[model samples]
Target: MIERELVIVGGGPSGMAAAIAARENGVKDILLLERDQYLGGILNQCVHTGFGLEYFKEVLTGPEYADRFIKKIRGLPDIEISLRSFAVGMTGDKVVTFLKPGRMERVKARAIIMATGCREKTREMVHIAGTRPSGIFSAGFAQKLINIEGLLPGKEVVIVGSGDIGLIMARRFVLEGAKVSGVVEIQGQSRGLVRNIVQCIEDFDIPIYFNHKISRIYGRDRVEALDAVRVDENFNEISGTKFALKCDTILMSVGLIPENELIEMAGVAIDRKTNSPVSEELNKTSVPGIFVCGNSFKVYDIVDSVTRDSLAAGKLAAEYLGRARA
Candidate 1:
């Protein structure tokens, strides 16, 4: 029956940054909860060096970028970090239910930070007509499997989104010795950056198909091939435009949605647009003391931006507890 001044749900860049800011601004009895065995979220699997260009003015790997906040919090006494703890449920009664190693615990907090990040849109969401293959993976999930677990998702791959993550994985899979058949996009213009298109696709001689989509996936136990077809302005398939590619893997990087299941359970009003708890400029949710930030608030393009947004949430949460937050 312990109580906390503030409880931050997540341990990614935003949650870590918020806890650090709250501690620095004189908040006490603050707790940070993470579901994974470690602190960083998706950043733990991103080994490439492109993050932190704006915040730190230097290129850093994703893990390195997350480390910048995590290391600082290690020295703070006001913050308690709960690793392997999942913040499962939230209620309007100001109670949070979480599970640790073996036991479930409940804690009441004066204020809460919902910093859970983003979720990848899957093949079902994209409506890709394909066999249920084992090799198909979301780009981020593939990144985790490849980089974190040191496993190769497939030997040959066809990427189905010219997104930042999908394109990046094109390079990553190549560097890992997988042959990239091509990158295909349903949109006329790519959803990724120009630099990524140049570096990951063009430089590698991996062909890119615009105004195209994966219409079907064919295989038995594992993916053996896939069909890419051109779509009309109305998204209806253009006849006689189907092309098949031989590959064992299909990587999808369609879109990101904010994670807000718990935010909804808390009886907080969420924006259908951001898919996050709706808040004003002060970042306060419809519920009196609940707040949200980072990708949980909106699908931001950069982690550095998420960190800055978290600082605002931390300040506002502190202010609610009678601490004059900056």
Candidate 2:
């Protein structure tokens, strides 16, 4: 196996920031592996302007924010980037196995940083009883379909959960000439930021039903409607509050969970509640020389926070390498 001083298992904002930090801290032979064809990850699909306010002190779109880091990574020759490289396995001793286009490779690194990001909660995860239909999509997947693939998922939409992504999509669907019936949230208030709730829902005059839940989905071949009901403080459905939301599509934007399976494969202790590594300190995992940052460690509210946390992780990895060499 090839030997590396440091290996970062993602190429999004977190991985890029960590790699850059490690290289600047005097660690050489670093490798960054990204499963996607591009390095930006989900940012590539986010065409809206709201990022980089904290880090760059300027408002930028997701792609633009990611480009700033990507350029820095390109300038650093010490950090090698491997696009379309999926890390499949990792060992407790820092052995990482990944797959490329035509070959599989392994690297034994002195230190490893996981920046694997987070995954969206789907319809099944939320326990929305529904037929396996065509029109249901996660809010993030809808963003990709609309912004990346240039495909409209549906014409009439009922968004479940007023999470940031769902709120954003409510406006996006309206902008694309689709009718958004309303945003349904089981909680008493929206789960998204104040700005998102204002700009995406309130400003657009999109109705949001608080204390409401999607109890069931109605469809034959595609989404036709949804059974919406109000819930009490205990989340039990309220009687006489059942209603039908006639729509062709359902977008779920409940929440995000950290992607930590790779670290778990490495014998790292995980907190069952958060599904993240059990770290006593920021970015420091239970296993020595293994670090985690960004959404893989825990979902953050903004990209700027992810960058800051990842820079710290990179510094920690560099410090670990220094001790190993000593």
Candidate 2 stretches with Cα past 4 Å from truth are: 323-326
In the range 28-124, model 2's lDDT, one tens digit per residue, is: 8999999999998888988898999999999999999999998889998878899999999999999999999999999999999999999998888
lDDT of 2 at 125: 84
Clashes (N, CA, C under 3 Å) per candidate = 0, 0
* Runs in model 1 lying further than 4 Å from the true structure: none
Q: What lDDT does each candidate get? A: 0.89, 0.93
List the lowest-lDDT window of 10 residues for candidate 1: 274-283
Top model by lDDT, which number? 2
TM-score of each: 0.96, 0.98
Q: Model 1: per-residue lDDT, tens digit, 220-268?
A: 8999999999999887899999999999999999988999999799899
